[model samples]
Target chain A: MASGILLIPGPIVISENVQKALGTPSVSHTSPEFVDLFASTLQKTRQLFQAGESAQPLIVAGSGTLGWDMAASNLIEPGAKVLVLSTGFFSDSFAECLQTYGAHVDKLTAPLGGVVPLSDIRKTLGGQKYEMIVITHVDTSTAVLSDVKSISEVVKNVSPDTLITVDGVCSIGCEEFAFDAWGIDYALSASQKAIGCPPGLSISVLSSRAIEVALNRKSQSSFFASFKKWIPIMQNYEQSKAAYFATPAVQLVNALNVSIGEILEQGLEARIAKHHATSDWFKNKLRTEKGLKLVSSNQRVSAHGLTAVYVKKPAEAISALKKKGIIIAGGIHKDIKGEYIRVGHMGESACNDSLCHIQLCYEALSELEL
Target chain B: MASGILLIPGPIVISENVQKALGTPSVSHTSPEFVDLFASTLQKTRQLFQAGESAQPLIVAGSGTLGWDMAASNLIEPGAKVLVLSTGFFSDSFAECLQTYGAHVDKLTAPLGGVVPLSDIRKTLGGQKYEMIVITHVDTSTAVLSDVKSISEVVKNVSPDTLITVDGVCSIGCEEFAFDAWGIDYALSASQKAIGCPPGLSISVLSSRAIEVALNRKSQSSFFASFKKWIPIMQNYEQSKAAYFATPAVQLVNALNVSIGEILEQGLEARIAKHHATSDWFKNKLRTEKGLKLVSSNQRVSAHGLTAVYVKKPAEAISALKKKGIIIAGGIHKDIKGEYIRVGHMGESACNDSLCHIQLCYEALSELEL
Candidate 1:
């Protein structure tokens, strides 16, 4: 009964209306009701990506990690070399996924608490035989936002043929971006993050070029990962026909539909701006407080999601906070786990005040006498 | 709101209690409430599999088709030959998926509405090399259940080393089977089917040997499809921890938890018996009325699921029925769309009296002069 503030990054707290939408009477997956649901959800996802007529948005049933696999499988062919600009934990996973898909992945590694080195990637692209470039924007693990825009510019200048993709799982609605204007070929995010839906669906928006490559990539993409299966399903999706495959997670889709409705109705610009303001306020609060330090020392910080604050006896502080019904997350990735704690500022938690959660962490840690 | 019987195949209608469970106020995926929800749902799933003391169930976030990928990726190595006994639409999809996972697949194909020739599969096994075998019990696309017991017996005798896996997506709680007793290494089903939740989470039970294979075959299984990732995460899941590696579709998990409660309380045996009775009653009505003929003439019909009826102007009959507020379904993978209509009899619809649905269908079709 005592559900405290979800100040850890995604899956952030979902709204009450969204939760009510999920409880809507269970419907057949193939029933006319679900097609309308899928259609509406798909359209909302496309709007988030700013996808034009040439692009298509795909909703696959899985976690955000699966989105990386879907992107790798569709865009890259066996033996193709890809450049993975690793800013944090997520890009590392994306690199491993690329390797699994038979791509020779080259990682341009950056420190966990730092940004992608655009110049270094440019040099690598200048000399390498890579066919694709992948960037992770706002790696949820370390709270580091990569410079996807700068990296894209450099990569396009050096290797124009390279596919430009971003693992935007931790960013999206919370972050400001122009997908079409920036020429992003593929952008992937999950419902759990700034989208404010409980996780289970990974949404991917693909440019015309990415679709062309997917269609041309010799063999069919892994069946579950295939956009082709969803393409016609969405095209013919009307109230009367049965869904093409098995029924989808109808309740989750409904939750997403409601969340997206709130997002667009309020306007994305206002939402993203509010997230930045809330993050700025939350970070300022953490900064003014005693005993906590920002992991990323530079002013250039992740604008719209979680923040990492280094603390002494970090595990004890997290444990004590959990005991008080205010659960903050521990640092992720092999690089930063023991030294810092994460405070999520995304979705409902982003706009709503989590001052009590931040205050609870401080008070609990003080009791530990650390 | 005239909510008639949802006498359609999966995703069948879930109980009102289960549907209402989705209203349990949304929580962040990493919220303690959600972790407890996931852990509880999983325990219930394990009870269903009766996955002995040593075996485990890996709950995945995706369609049941993803199950074929999970089974193949974990068991079949690159170039690992596998045998598929294809009976219907889903079986072929499994074979195709195995092929994607780098297996040399040989299929013993059965005609539509038919089960594979067990003798032919034994013959194929004796001549071929395989690491695993794929079989489907009660193909949703055909309303036909293959003889899993007979097939497993033949595989055990002729090819003991090969793992036998069953796709019980349409059969799980609707019929009875012992994963261990039948020599099955893996059994997979979707929550949207007999378990009667909604679509998108896939539930699979692994034999102890299967888990060992999964752990040992890390070199082969794609990361997303690996049971290793699933095991540690689930093992650590508890009532108090926030489980947030990926977004988990929290509300759906809650709905499934509620569905599982109803299932266990209702008793698995009772549920399956209800399905059997309803399917029998429905089939009898179709046969005696001369309004339609069974498309699946095989003696071994799926005991507790659907009855695909052959009727003139099947599409018109289905459309007409839809207009009359009594919704049903049609046959799949038969190379033609309108020759047959599949009337589902599982989950909430399993206990349904066929008299009303039949009468309504007759009225609707007669009005259309079909």
Candidate 2:
């Protein structure tokens, strides 16, 4: 069972406490204790999002892609227009998912290393009415971060009726996101990423307006992804009543409860600041010492959880890091798939001092011939 | 952390080995070692299903209900005709899920404690062509076991083109089912049931014909549940290549691999027989020794994994058992919701004599003043 340090963008190195929670004996999904745990976990997720009283949180058994499916299936009816702000691979995938459920999607793509400009978004909004607008807060593929707050502001000013959804899969816990303040209608994330839990659950916070649209949808294209069926279930669980639409992943939900509790104990602001500082330090070290160029053109739009860096012989560099007991990822962006590598600096690896994962990555890269 | 013996139908008592696997260090989904594990696990799942080489096994991160959604979204196109053979609550729910995806569903429901007659199925098939026929192998609500093999045979004889889908969530590892021999097009189950793993993954085996239907569909009704999108990814993983459509539930998959390995070690036939023997012993003790009635009318129709016994005071009896360090489930079938209780005997609890789970249930029931 010997393993190297995990530096992938998600399925990050979980804390021992969280792992213990995952190992807890299986419990019935309808048990009173599990209902309380589930309810508390949902409430803590709201705290993580900094959502208001009108927002509802859902924890479903699936990966982050399920979160995208939830938004597409629940909020948008068939043939409804959706504006997808494509920052990278994930955003484009979101648009594709929307299309799968019969939505007429219009994607506004950004350049390879940037997000769409606010003026372009405004112009797009003015041209036609949209049912929803999706923005990826941090695209894991390219490590590009979008200005969600500014985009939310512009959308609210120009098209207030359009729902605002943020794909926070790679950003939620590590990055600063104010669900209430930014006026986001839905923020979807997974347990694996910066949440510091194992992969399994798709967590999302939905505003009351989003729930309203879901409830009033003319036709539902999916069953498992429908928010209307799940909202009451979630609400009932949060009220300490056992309700079932489906049997949840008991172990993963327990792990999430423990992990979110840890996040709150450390304070969300401090955790985000820690990620920001560690990311800056690691990116700077790579630049100054290894002469590696990041895929992100500027620091302003770079993700704080992971850095995608261009390097010669990306595969060789990754192998060398693996040899040094560190596991980093190769680039995933289609155009530069072989030209860069990615090093994640989130969760326990970013917040704790034991691993010094940043230094390990730098040392591993320096020893490599690339 | 002192817990009682879990006798509920699902999320049942997990083995120590599987729980230990759940606490394994998180690994990257694309890691070569994980890829090997994933491939081996998928192959082992085929062995569990007794499926042939042509059948494809998929392990997705979701509950059993997601399996229904996957079947509906992938196999049944919008406005397509489907025949739903309803045994109990879960079967009706499956019909609802199919209709949500725009399927024209015609449901033939069995009586409270009985299964749909094979003659009725044959008559229905003779009337019109159906795109698919869904059978819940063992309805969890009433513990009623449908004769899936006979049903499949009737479907094949009457309308060979119609796909035969079995909801094996409550029966897969405990019941005797031969996917290839029975001509089952799709068999779907969950991790937490008889598989002895925690809940999260939706496990299924699809015949080559089912795969073809999914690939050649004019349009995918759902994104995450799309077989066309996932087939390649699943195949690539089984080929030991790192492919990603969505981040997997790495730890749970690892746990499943371990649990399935244990099942193989015990031998599937032996495990099934053990469940059958223990179920017979428990049911006989409840009926002859305690004068309790079962919701399932006869032994031939009773599920091997769980028993639904009718009691005058179901809730009080369940609470009384709980107070004496036992956990059982109240009835869920609408006709006898408050009249029966369920006790499960499956997985390690059924196969091994160490826990004496069945004996414990009998002792607990004997202590109850029913």
Candidate 3:
């Protein structure tokens, strides 16, 4: 039934190899073959974040939102101060998640279609003794890309002891991330989006420091996402040993293994550049040729994975594109809920030149007169 | 790599149709087509549980363990007393999850390879007023089955106000369940077990009373598994309206849609009966013909979904069966973990006569000296 070209921000088009892996017949999660695959996939997940051997990667069965919960539950104890750099709906939700775990949250929201300024972050960090600072690398709602590297630098300089976390749900596979080099304590993403797999696995990478902090936490508040429970299991899996806390989503892990292999095969730098190039090409076409306004304020801050443009009639444009067999998403940011349409150019759409998915979307939009 | 007759207690062999569904191409979670499919799948999930219209079914992207987190985080507030009827590892883990969420858990563990008696449950209920009583319908580790109807009746008679919850992760599709008739307040399962789908989706059904209790919680503790956030979204999706809290695993949901349809097509009664027949046949062959002892003390309390049996050396038997192209699980009950093996007989292996998977497993086990 999902016949059309899917262009959603996440749950983007999956590759053929990934789909085949998804259909793999029942394999015991504890089997040697699965263990080897899972081990390799965990290592590859580190590579996706540009992380080193010291960094630990976790692939659990949940959406990207679960990553936020994991970070909140494992890292932030009650009454701990956390600064959230809010770019859009996702960042706000991340703040809400921290608050849910009893973290004292201070949100620094950017203007509509822009990121929170580095100066504002520095000032906020200076004002408080925070346990952690969260930055969304790319907020899907606004298609706004925050500069994680710069923000991490600010956190390191202004509040050296604070843990720097990144919500890379929409950025990890399609954008530049150097987990070790950038001094990021933790970052999380999903299997879909730029990873080109179906949505299920919540992928994340944590520096050794983050893991140590989690290990030494005074109180533990989670079970499924508990670092105490999962850390050893992940370590054992990385060593190709069978260890079970809860049952892993076997097929999704297999699919992720295949997808991450493809990503590594293409190389992350080239893949990220391809997404940027495609984003530039499509955004140029929409702005200059089609006379459209983007939800992202400028190319400097725009995300490479998706384009959120303010259309005259967002719903009508989406319907028209749907009729032409090109599926796109409508606005999700509360302020611009019905004001724009989002077209994802990540995964196969951006990486596979022969697919021409972005061109198809552009042509469909040309027909819509939006 | 998974080539064999997979006989693990859960993550059992999936059917061809379910595998095909799992490999479905990318689809937007918010698309009309996916929404409609999801709506139908939700209804089918209700049917899978034999639940009434007043019940709400939630299919989230996680393992069955997340269901315990959801139930604990949403229904049990801090300091609330909960009685966990522990049959084995899974039930003990469920109690841990409740305790993690700040619930005051009182565990009543049964003997090895046996279920907690209804009389014990009744006495426990009479001793203290509990906010909820947790039961594992079938503990995969021990292959012990708890009579949910009788247990629920006992709870109803002793403590009518207490919520009755069932962890049916290893039981649902292959075992008899009458949600309304059994007066089950909440029941949770995973797709990989009896449902014949790849592992990813955490499926749960909650009665109106359970929903009310969840909604009425004084303080919410979770962000990802929160009932408050998911309730409206589920309601909207069930009505074929697009609503988003967190992204759904589109492919997993599609596979579940098809699997549940097949489960309903065969009829729950027939499907469940087939599992019982298969279990009886296999257990009889193991006990009488093969001269092996089962972990389950008697046939009455043995689970129909899987068989846990004692062997001279479980690891050797598992390896010997593996050499003959059959995959059986090593025991996981903490006490007899090394002495026995577990053979899953659910879904296609149990219900589809054409598969002959159970027979293959029997023949393979017969070859083993253990």
Candidate 4:
């Protein structure tokens, strides 16, 4: 079967090494080798997140949305107030997820192409006490990047007790995020996206404060997403011991270990800089050379992993790109569903010189009637 | 890296074709090809379950335990009474999962290496009103297969309104289960068990009644595991349309499509029979030749996908098998936690004679000092 370039927001182009790792023969989840792999992966995740010794990492078999469930079910008790900083579709979904877990969610939504201002966040935190504040580091829908560092600072100043949770699905590997320095209580990501692996595992790092809140929850509302059941299992595995609460996605985790290894080998800071430079170059080409506009509207608010571009006849442009053996995404933000397209440049697509995904995408767009 | 044969209860030996599919280039989850693949996979899952038109199949990114969460969080409302027929560790875990969702649980537990009596179930149903009854078709820990057909019949006769939920994580593809004819409401399985795929996806078939229960629930208590959000997305995807809630695991789903296609090509009945034959052959060799006893005690109640043999020095036996490039599992049932070892014969390992996994396992066991 002929395969095309994947330029969508996630499940992006994976490195050959990572793909090979994914196809490695299935191993017993409790096998000593697998345990070692799991342990090393956890330790590397801490390094990637720049987390302190007080932080714990969890790798569960699920998509990125499971991360939201983990934070909601574990940290916030039923009826607790949560403040969601919404920039796009994913932020709204995160809010809905909190509500499903019986948390009273208040969303401070930004303009469609903008991030919530630090002033607004400070005012919101000053007015009421929130058990947690959720920030989508980069909302995939609009390719908007929130100011997590600044938001963390505001929350620390106004409400030191409010836990800060970040949806890092679209940004973790590509964007510059310091969990320890930023004082993020919980940051959740997935194996796909900038991680350069297939989608399956929900990866998260938790602060001691977050773990404490989870342990003191009045009652747990989930089973698979429950941190209580998984904490010991993760801790055991990272300690190179076999503990089974549930059978993990063995192959996916194997691929994750490989991909994360590649990321660390490339150096996290260097990887982030590469993503930023590639994204800036691609966005500049689209704006100046093709006379196109972006959903994020400005570089400061734009995500480094993906670029959402406004276009006329998005279906036609997407079809034209597909005919060129490339795949991009249409707008997902509800208010501007059909007016734009999203192209992701992360992981191997951004780092590898030979892929030339950016050039191909630009050529495809330039050739489009729109 | 030298890989050993996986004879554990799950994360079993997968086929080359399935592994190749796992490494297939990443594609947009919303792409037409992926949508068709997702739709066909769901349809094939229904066929695998022998589910009628009134049934809907769901594929979520998680392990088998996530299926338990789906059943509990979707079907049973908080404070509703649930009857769990427990045979081993997995069954007890399922009950714990249900209780985590606030279900009031009453467990009709079997003695170690036994199944709960149908008469006891009838008596229990006659005495109390249960919103749901959960049965582990084949509990992985003990290699005990519950008579799901008979249990479903008893439940139908005693209380027709009570939803019957079967934990088929270890049994679905290898055990003979007729979802529609047996009147099962919800049956949950995983990709890694008997399905000949790497672990990640929670595959479940839900009756229309169960879907209705999910739809009309007073409030959804889960964000990621919520059926209310996922049901429409599933329906849309199966209809060859792109609908987003959470990003589905694209590569794993692709692998699932291939594995399920292989199962369908082999014919579900033939596949189940192959597992049974292979299991019986392996068990006979252990019993007659090696003079080894099994945890299930009798063939009539034993699981076809795996055999749990009581052994002296399980750790040493496991180590011996591992040294011979074979991997088997140790006892997990609390009562016999250190008393036996589990050898799995399922999926491609059972159907493909070229693997020689059963023979290798037998040889490894025979070489071990009794």
Candidate 5:
């Protein structure tokens, strides 16, 4: 608790309970107790995505980058046609990930800080015989929230056989994602960003349709990404044993249980509204300062997560802030690198506690002589 | 320290220092301090691997299971011939892994509880062309240690172009490995096992030749398993700005560093011999018991780790042991399920210190009347 607050997008403010969970002694992944923890985490993870009956969850060993790979490799095999709806850098990376696995990736791009239109997605899908469609729920780099539900609708109407997947790495726990209702076959996420757990493992919620595709795959398309092993393990532990795979990062999983509990107990709708209000409050403070602007428009912007803004003398601004223990992320996207700064209001301590620091950041910015 | 002892193979034991490290608290992975810690761990890991300029240690998120995918997907493309040396459960998993990635896998299998013969491997390689060879260095299930030096020597004589990959999950920290000396293209292990840390991230060492083969492949791998993404990230991080992709499981990384320091300071050779002595002593004690015998041979065994014993009721034996707070792992491999029990003597308690509860276990087994 004495450590400085993490104001950056991810690996953000872990709660005291979450921190304590890390101190819990390690346990074997194959052990019944560990399986219980893993299964419990999965059950809760499904709740976050609002997954349906057939929505099986899988845990992979890496960053959200692994999620991009799972979506591409498991569903979009070589020569498979896929469409990626891009909002910013993350979407571009997801598309690149698809291409890496030999998927014919078609990017439906909008302007640098804008969301892709559903009509654009339909047009892209109409022209291509795509087997999978991927939409970024919220691209972290741009802080833009795409109309993924509408896009999924458009894809389903245009290409009925196409499997809809959402790159919800930054959105799932912080934003709204109804996987089944949105016709999402798979929704992928990581715990570091909004889930308030330290990063290491990647998580995915697979709809029954996605499970079918995995079951029918040409036999274990991936050793690490295989749902076959996880599914049986998950099933076998239905009553008592809860985890599948080797020992999980037990401490992180335990912490995630706490973070998720706190959020739900406080209520998801309240959390979402608080995030939106905080995003506005941060921008309001920034607007009072000279020559600073929010990159994302309110219409298609991320809520319950972040508000990225542009500022001149960026390096100096970033360094000055970090020197004070108020660290912010530097923009790395081609369009905004060195030209913008982002404030992450996503995790445990990201609400009322950060307001004081947000004011200090504004004061710090105004004091700077450009 | 108040927690009960872990007699399981992996997730074995955590020292007070490692526990303090895990409890040290979380930090932003991108922060300068964290980068310093991350880089420090990298340097320490390289020293542990005994890797030279031509080799580098790469880390990935997830368990040891993820290592097989990283090695195979990066090195083998479609129809890449692979020779798999199977000594036990974990070794055989490699063949399944290679075949999943479109490799023509030819497995050289030994008996369920025996080491693979060097001649069998040479004969398999002589009749066909294999681009790579997969060897599990120490399989905990069977407590069998493959003669890696002999296997690599035969591999070199028979097929010079073949890449030898060793799954060093249970051996790297407990036993010994020489990357450049053994001509091993890749060596994979997880933190939970002999390395003595929480289970989540993987520590794998890859050679320049392996990286070259990965780079030369026409089909680029998906993001998670792509060595290209990792090679650059790991190939040089002492000075690179981009040190980590995901928010690392910080506390666990700290725990790993502490465990490594303890292992290095104590000396691996000395520690391994201690493990051997303890296992030998435990087996001697168990042999004196009325109904217990080791499943693995005295000569072809893992000295730096656990000793699995075949029994009439393995689960009952383990369950009874756990009742006395003397835990041991139940056999999970299909061939030996419900027939063998494993007691690990690795990590923090790799000596007689780990045997404090051995007599207690014997007492429980004797009183159970089974």
Candidate 6:
């Protein structure tokens, strides 16, 4: 096991109980106990997304990228047009994933460290009909937060048929999201990130309409990611029935269940508040005390889970922080790839005031001359 | 953690070391420590597959089903004719997966608990040229092992250009396999089963020829499973360089590394021999002492990892074993779905004699009047 505080966007610091859950002995996926646990986990996933009873949750054995593939394969058939709100590297990748599945992609590039304006999205939607609209809730590459609720509202007004999809890989657990109220058709995240679990399972929640769109698609191009193949299996598991389409990541699912339980037990509203407060403090310290420019442009648009800061020498700063037992990430955004560094303050690290993970990271980073 | 012994085909008993590895602290995928460890794990995977240095191993975050997607998306172009040797349910699923990617699949299904005839395969190859041929090394549904080496030899003789692929989901670690010697182009497996790791990673080793086919394919329809995107990332990782296509399952990979190390430490030949011995003893007891028929046609074709025995009441037998704190699986083969029960005797359970997992399972089944 690699040590030191992991301050990357993800796979972030996992809590002790979640870690213990990950190491659980192997169990039959079909066993009644596992089925019940799985059912609860799926329901917990729905809660994590703040989704209602009509929504369906899918927890598959894959990274967050598989979620992109699922959306591409299930929602967009060949010749379909998709509008991608590109915040940074991850959004660009999602667009690429869609193209791979034969979707005609139109990208609305956000300004560096900023989100695509709602006006621009509405204008684009008015000009052309899109099968889907993708929004990166918080792009890890830039730490830029998109206003998903506003974006969905714009899409709903301009093109009611356009399915609103949120790439919540970075935002889901820590950020405030209301699936029903926000009118999100589909959203996806991973186990790692703010969920505080190992990086294996791709957790997605789909609106009933989105599920219907997936089910009624003309052709399913991919089998493993095909929603048609997975929906019934997920429905079966959620109903505490044994069903198998593909073997699930049982241990990872167990870990996710534990982490989601902890997330809910602490309460989502309080957890989101803690993350926001942590982000505010850390960003304030970086801007005022350290005199550093953040990549998110402004506090209002910045993601609460993480922050990207411009560094004079990112590699040197990273190495220096490593010496202090702090692990941070270098830049990944293509336009400013080598110009900044990122620090994550979410999950147990941000929620638990006693851990002082954010404080430790700030202190270590302050020591860096870069 | 769901307790009791897990005797299912995949997601079998994970060793203590492997479980400990699974709970490892969060690590950056790009960190030197993790990169080096991942590179080492990839090398160990090559050894596990018994492949030459020319072969490449992919350890992606997914279930064994994702392996089929990889093969379908990477190797088979749309409208390409592919031959699927159907041993049981898994083979049929593999065929379905290939067809989902627009492949024209020709399934050569064997009789219940039987292997496809070599002469029939030769005749099929002689009748039409195929782009690929898929063989299920061990169809978990029936516990019937295919003669991969012999089949690969026949493919080489009849249609040298046809890529030979093996589904080693239930066979990899426990069964005797020689990637290079058998002239197999691609072989895919899972972290669970004989690997004795958690059920998350989809592991595959591809020959240079298979890589060429993937890279030179006309158009890639799938993004997550596409080798075009993964190959470069895998190459960079193998060279101990940081390159990201998607976030890896860090903890699962760590556990897989530990498990692979254990497998190598035990020696593949001895491990295979041990599984064979265990399977022979258990199967003989079922047939001779208990007077029960096996789903497998004969001893020669039975898989070493698991056994499927025909029982009067599979559900009753399974419930009875569950009561004794031993978990086994009911048959899944479509034809004899509920007539037989499966007991996995692979990994630590079968290899570690002192555990007597197989003996306990046998005794539990013996106690069942059904």
1 or 3, greater by TM-score:
3
- Candidate 2 wrong stretches, greater than 4 Å: none
Local distance difference test, each candidate = 0.74, 0.91, 0.90, 0.90, 0.75, 0.92
Which candidate do you rate higher for lDDT, 2 or 6? 6
Which CAPRI tier for candidate 5? Answer: medium
Write one digit per residue (lDDT tens) for candidate 5, span A1-370: 1236567778677777777777778765566666676667677777777875577876655678878777777776688888788888888888888887778887778787778776777787788788988888888888888877787778778998999888887787677778888888988888778777767768788888888887778755677776766666666554566444555666667667776766766776676666667666677767664646777765455445877888887778778877777777878678678888877777664545644655666566667753
Q: What is the TM-score of each candidate against the true structure?
A: 0.93, 0.99, 0.99, 0.98, 0.94, 0.99
A1-370 per-residue lDDT for model 2 (tens digits):
3358999898899998999999877887888888889999999999999997799999999999999899999988878899999888899999999998878999999999888999999999999999999999999989999999999999999999999999999999999999999999999999998999999999999998998888888777789998988999999998899998999999999999999999999999999999999999988988888777888888999999999999889988888788888999988888889999988888999999887878787777887765
Candidate 3 residue spans exceeding 4 A from truth: none
Which TM-score value belongs to model 1? Answer: 0.93
Candidate 4 DockQ, CA atoms: 0.76
Of candidates 4 and 3, the better by lDDT: 4
Off by over 4 Å in 5: A1-3, A242-244, A288-291, A352-360, B1-3, B244-247, B289-291, B351-370
Candidate 4 chain A: minimum summed lDDT over ten consecutive residues — where?
A1-10
State the lDDT of candidate 1 residue by residue for B1-370, as single tens digits: 1225455676666777777776665465655566777777778887786566566776777878778878877776878888887767888888888887778888887776677777788888899768898888887777777888888999889989999889988888887767878888999988887787877788888888888888887574466776767766766674356544455666667777887777778888787787777777667766675656665655465545777777777778776777666677877765745688777666665543444554455445446543
- lDDT per residue for candidate 2 within B141-234, as digits (tens), equals 9999999989888998999999999999999999999999999999999999999999999999999999999999998888888898788999
Candidate 1: regions farther than 4 A off: A235-246, A352-370, B1-5, B28-36, B238-245, B352-370
Docking class of 1: medium
lDDT of 2 at B247: 89
RMSD in Å for model 4: 1.2
Candidate 3, residues B198-232, lDDT tens digits: the string is 88889999999999988887787899999989888
In the range B269-312, model 5's lDDT, one tens digit per residue, is: 77667666766667776777655677777655544587777878
Tell me the RMSD of model 3 versus the true structure.
1.1
True lDDT of residue A110, candidate 5: 73
Give the range where candidate 4 chain B is weakest over 10 consecutive residues by summed lDDT. B1-10
Ranking by lDDT: 6, 2, 4, 3, 5, 1
Winning model by lDDT: 6
Q: Which of the predicted structures, 4 or 6, would earn the higher DockQ when compared with the native?
A: 6
